[model samples]
Target chain A: MATKKTIAIIGASGNMGSAIAKSLANAPYRILLFGKEEAKLKSLFKEIKNTNKKADAEIIGCAADASWEADIIIAAVPFAAEKDIAEKIRQVATGKIVISISNPLNETYTGLVTSSDTSSAEELQKLLPHSKVIKAFNTTFAGDFSQPVINGKTIDAFIAGNDEEALETVSDVVRSAGFNPIKAGALAVSRTLENMQSLLIQLSIKNNYNQVAGWKILHN
Target chain B: MATGILLFQSITVILYYNNMYEVLFENVSKKIGLTKEEEQLLQTFFIPKKLRKKQYLLQEGDVSKYLAFVEKGMLRSYTVDEKGIEHIAEFAFEGWWMGDQFSFLTGEPSKYNIDALEDSELLLLTKQAEDQMLEKIPKMERFFRLLLQNHLIAIQGRLASSLSNTAEEKYNQLVQACPTIPQRVPQHMLASYLGITPETLSRLRKNISLRK
Candidate 1:
């Protein structure tokens, strides 16, 4: 029997981080929940264990400062802490697949923080120069990750990275979670993805969509 | 002969309105295939208005009541910084939509100002009319959603460039995106659009020519 791959989700106590952790819990992989609050991490692990009881997967919880031991690390922390986490985990993240779901939205959520030419994921990659960074899940809401299907439609997960292997690894995980993983070119494409987050957030707040809406790329 | 001339004048008037509505319908249809009934319903939702040069469509501190779609001529949306310097946020010419998204969406007082650069013809849609149109034609929702998506992308890109890119790079990008903007807009307005001083823009242009 082959050993299952390990996936660590940083800031696992947060809505987006925990939702992704819960969604990927059923996959044939070990889930490690990392966060600053130990109690919150433990509770999130418990919830994941409760919901994914039938799935053959192991789960663990640890602090943000803990040494990471995973094949893939998802930095699902807030945009403000992205650089700090990237800098902290740079050593352990080396040669590992790092996925960024942080949207560089301004504090008010009305606009983006990063420039249009760059993205949070790209900044993370620069911080963790040894890690292969891939941008995914930034455009998606935490509300959709629990099901990956909304209104009987498969939500599109726009994945972008310079590394092909990293993209495929993340895409396979996304596919396992019941989403249509869309390869949106390179890591720089995260600019568009993050902007899409701002747009979705604005639309939801103003139009009363309740923050549950997901993007679906309709093609003829 | 008088009746014939009156008939010709009426035909011209019909063609003029048809041309305006035609451009709008074409813009909407590019996203979703709208039925003839949906198109007509969509047309009824818009209130046609014309603004002379330097006339305001939306002013700061006023709630943006309508999203204006330009049928002809140009309009510019701008803001005044703390220093009382005008900064161009967006420039809308033919087939483009203009309004403060925040104000239009939330019915809040606008921080931006939208004014006509030339005598401009626009089709304005209020939130109430938009709601009725969406109810009558659900496909219109998709059109608006796509519009929002595209708008988001463009604004995000602009924000990103302003944050990180050099003034020279920004200038090159603006030129690449709309090659004719410099020719159509005044130097000061173009400088404001680039978030740079007119003096810097002149220097950049001079450097480019010198390098050539």
Candidate 2:
């Protein structure tokens, strides 16, 4: 359903946002990215366009605050600004799918400090009741977005949300990015996926590695 | 006559304060600073429980009924991998709170289990009791919200630490927080909780003490 669709990513000038923008470059989608710093976002667009990809897709940068508009707002902001961005996205994305990729991590980025009940995705759901909120693309490391394959094979992309149709739409986007979409469960299940990132990051740090070669979650 | 009631109420408060000095509740008041009344109220609801090693406080697919505060001994909340290996999610000992937050909040089946890492005692509050306590003390909501907020901060800290700090640094921070936890818990469990292999932890310890 995300085929040739218009997509907007909030907090788009950051590492994860740019990685996502790069991955979607060749997909059948138009990427519109929003950032707090308009000039920085413009530069990000230039950098994205500078890349050579066969998809040759369009990447547009907009000067909208996260507290404002668009369809398919992928909030890749840091955890602190997640709820604030969600509140803002709720105001604009009426009946639109708001994709949340925010991961709540411990200071060490190793263990979880949040109790089971307190996940950013769950809080975003409560904060944005009107929008079709879905959690996806958060589990993958920033470096792994471009190279989704590990050991010469594709890796699983986990997605979950309350709205089934919204979830499927997001899954379609995951597939578009050339990754496997594994529907974990409802949005509450996202806490596990998000938490899994903590476990992975811990392993990465433990092994003295920082890139995708740092760790691998073998789904066999 | 009114003066007598004031004396009685004050006496009651004094009595409640007198009973508050055990291991689990100590830093809780210091860690989060629970009010005297709220502390007394929590004391009334937190049911005491004990678990032997290999016993679960809760199991997967079971609705978690209680949010437990660890009194003594270590507990591990974990999920079993497809290979049947347990991935330790959290480890609690002496004042740490352990429960599947997903199940604790939503009343749904939990994917993780909270098990006693050693012979452990917990002061737990059932879902019903927690609701009643919240109703009885509306401000208790603030207490729990603060607790959640603090936990979120810690989680964020760990995330940042993992990204920026070394394993030794993370381990050092843990040792600072609970100076005696490593000695109390099995090395393997501690390593798992630390997101490292037992061998790595052993090596790290060797590397540190050697430098010392």
In order of listing, the candidates' clash counts read 3, 21
lDDT tens digits by residue: candidate 2, A51-153: 7544433334432322222336687788778766654444344445778887878676766666887677888777866566788888777788878887787
Candidate 1 lDDT, A94-139, residue by residue in tens: 4567898988888788998788789899999889775779999887
Off by over 4 Å in 1: A1-3, A54-67, B1-212
Two-chain DockQ for model 2: 0.01
How much does each candidate deviate from the true structure in C-alpha RMSD? 25.5, 24.9
- For residue A217, model 1's alpha carbon misses the true position, in angstroms, by 1.0
List residue ranges in candidate 2 displaced over 4 A: A1-3, A52-69, A213-220, B1-212
Error of 1 at B25 (Å): 70
| DockQ (CA atoms), all models | 0.01, 0.01
* Model 1 chain A poorest ten-residue lDDT run: A58-67
Per residue, candidate 2 scores C-alpha lDDT tens digits across B159-200 of: 888788878898998899889877877888778767889999
Position A173, candidate 2: lDDT: 87
